[model samples]
Target: MIDSHAHLYYEKFDEDRDQVVLRAREAGVVRVINIGTDVATSEKSLELAKRYMGFYATVGLHPTTKVVDLLRDIALLETLAKANPDRVVGVGEIGLDYYWKDVAPAAQKESLAAQLDLARRLGLPVVYHCRDALEDLFAFLQQERIQPPGVFHCFSGGPSDAERALALGYHVSFAGNVTYPGAVNLQAALQVVPVEKLLLETDCPFLAPQPVRGKRNEPAHVGHTRDFIAKSKGIDPGELERITEATTVSLFGLS
Candidate 1:
């Protein structure tokens, strides 16, 4: 299985990062995409991608990060992607997040637009993170004409949101939160996501699945999410794994 999104470079895994990767391999997670939230973390992700065989990296600035000079940061992301075309798989973990009003909505929109433009210029896919700003995100995408060969990571939206994302040519990735007993909206969204556009992720060191909730998540725990999604969809777990794995590989251009 491919853990389509993870933050394996976070300090949470500092003590035993290698062991965590080993565990993921043992758990049948053949590939992991280490996502970036800012310049520093993006560089760290690149390093980890270089160090690990089945690991890939993405570069982007999270909406919540203070952007004193958005142009400079976007340029830095471009430089990184150009420098490591093989290792940098996409442009992502980038999108609107109104969950925390710390950053101005205008700035978040600006950063998202600039980054999307960068991805288009580079001929790379994207990994989006939308939280409490689905309406605004959809509006922006509609206005900008950004046809995504990308994904909506950790999707918690309703069926309409899933439909719109699918219409935009983006994959919908579910994470551990989908396993929560109370996640009715996610379940509804999952039902609308066709098998061809489905992807599974851990978003590790963050949203750990049930049976391991409240614990620091790792790539290995992706199996729990895969199993839950398969059960929710009433499909065989092995078949679900095969379909999602193929979708992930095709979306991210993984080897």
Candidate 2:
């Protein structure tokens, strides 16, 4: 199994980060792609990837924060990607996040389009973040027609939204939230999406699965989400693991 999205560089794992990595390995998760929202975290993720064998990182600007200088930030991010080609496998965890007010929708669109262009030019996949802005996201994607289609990380939508993502040629990643009792809509969406396009993530230290809900989520708990998904979809756990892992590897060009 692989955690397609994580924030291990976050301070939540500061005290026992190594232990967390060990726990993930012990739980059978072989690779983890630590996503970056900004420049500093991107660097931190690359550093984390260097210390861990099966870990990797990505560099891109997130829209949740203010875009102080878009061009300058993209240039730095591009430099990071070029300087560490092997470590930086993709470009993102980048996209619109209307849930926060720090960056307005216009800025979010601008930043997302820039990063999307970056991924296109680099010939790398993208990891998108969409919250309360799926319509705008779908619209932008429809117009942009990106190459090497990316993922919709932590997807939170209905079957229609899943259809939209599928139509956009993007993988739909599920986090622990899908195990929630109130996630019937998400469950329905999951049913429609083919297993080949399905990816799983922890998105920790947040959205722990139902079994560990309200606690700090970690990669070790990814299996819980995986198990729930497999059972929900009537797929063998082992089969689901193998297929999703291959999908992740193919999408990110992971070793």
Candidate 3:
């Protein structure tokens, strides 16, 4: 299975990074895509990819980072994208987050636009981080600023939203939140997403699946999410694994 979204290089896994990776491998997670939220973390992700065999990286400036200097962020991400073409697969964890509207949506829009442009120029898929503000997010996406296809990570929208994203040539990725008992809306949305455009992720050290909720998530826990998605889609776990693995590899252009 391909864990398309993970933050394995974060300090949360510093204590037992090796053990965590081993557990994930033993759990049958064949590859882990480590994502970056900034230039520093992007470099760290590249370094980790070099050190690990079944690991890859996605470099971009997360909107929440408040990187208003769009040009600088784009320049840095472009440099990294060129420096490690093989290691870097996507441009992401990038998008607007109005959850904290107190920070003004302008900055988020600026950063998202710049990064989307960078992704188009680099010809890399995107890993979007859309939290709340679905209408605004959809508006920007509809504006046609980006060309390459991508996925919306931790999708919290409804069925219509999922359809819209797919129409826009974006895949919908489910984090552990989909397994929560009260997430009826999310479950319904998941049902509408086509299997071909579906991907599984842990968003680790963050959204641990049920039974492991409130705990530090890891790539190994992606199996739980895979099980959840399979059950939701009325397909077997093995089939879910096969489809998601293929979709992830196709999205990242990984062999």
Candidate 4:
């Protein structure tokens, strides 16, 4: 399995980060994409990617972050990403989020616009993060300012969102949240998305599967989500793994 989105650089794993990677390997999650939300963490992701085999990194400014100088910030992110072509695979975990309402909507859009333009200019795919702003998220996506073949990571939408994402030539990745008992809408959207267009992620340090709920998530717990998705779709677990793995690798160009 490939954990398509993870923040192994997070302080939560500071003590046991190496062990977490080993646990992921033991659980058969061979390839991981360490996502970036800010300039510092993005550099850390590149450093960690170099330190670990089968690990890749992404560079982007997440919506939650304060949007200072959009152009300068995005330019720095682009420089960091371009400096490590061998390590950087995508531009993301960047998108709109209205959940907190603290970060001004205009600021989020400004950052998102700059980053989306950066992704297009860099010729890299994007990994999106949306929260309580799918409506505006879809609006930005439809504008075609960003490149194609990005992913809506940790998708929190219904069947209509999945369909629209597919229409836009983007993928929808489900994290451990799909295993929640109350994720009826997510489950239904899962059914709507063809396995070929699907990707799986742990989004670790968050969204631990039901079996390990209320715990700090690690890449190892991704299997629980995978197994749950397989069972929910009534397909062979191995087959699901193969398909998701292929789709993830092809999308991210991960080795």
Clash totals for all candidate models: 0, 0, 0, 0
Order the candidates by TM-score, highest first — what do you get? 2, 1, 4, 3
| lDDT (0 to 1) per candidate | 0.91, 0.91, 0.88, 0.89
Against the true structure, candidate 1 has what lDDT? 0.91
lDDT of 4 by residue, 1-255 (tens): 899999999889999999999999999999889999998889999999999999999998889987667777788888987888888999997998899876898888888777777887778889999999998988877886445568999999999988988888889889998999999999999998888888989999999999999999999999998899999889988999999999988887776
Per-candidate Cα RMSD to the true structure, in Å, reads 0.9, 0.9, 1.2, 1.1
Local accuracy of candidate 2 as per-residue lDDT tens digits, 140-235: 888875455789999988999999999888899999999999999999989988999999899999999999999999999999999999998899
Candidate 4: minimum summed lDDT over ten consecutive residues — where? 140-149
Tell me model 2's lDDT, rounded to 2 decimals.
Answer: 0.91
Runs with alpha carbons beyond 4 Å of true place in candidate 4? none
Candidate ordering by lDDT (highest first) = 1, 2, 4, 3
TM-score of decoy 4: 0.97
Candidate 2 TM-score over all chains jointly: 0.98
Off by over 4 Å in 3: none
Q: Each model's TM-score?
A: 0.98, 0.98, 0.97, 0.97
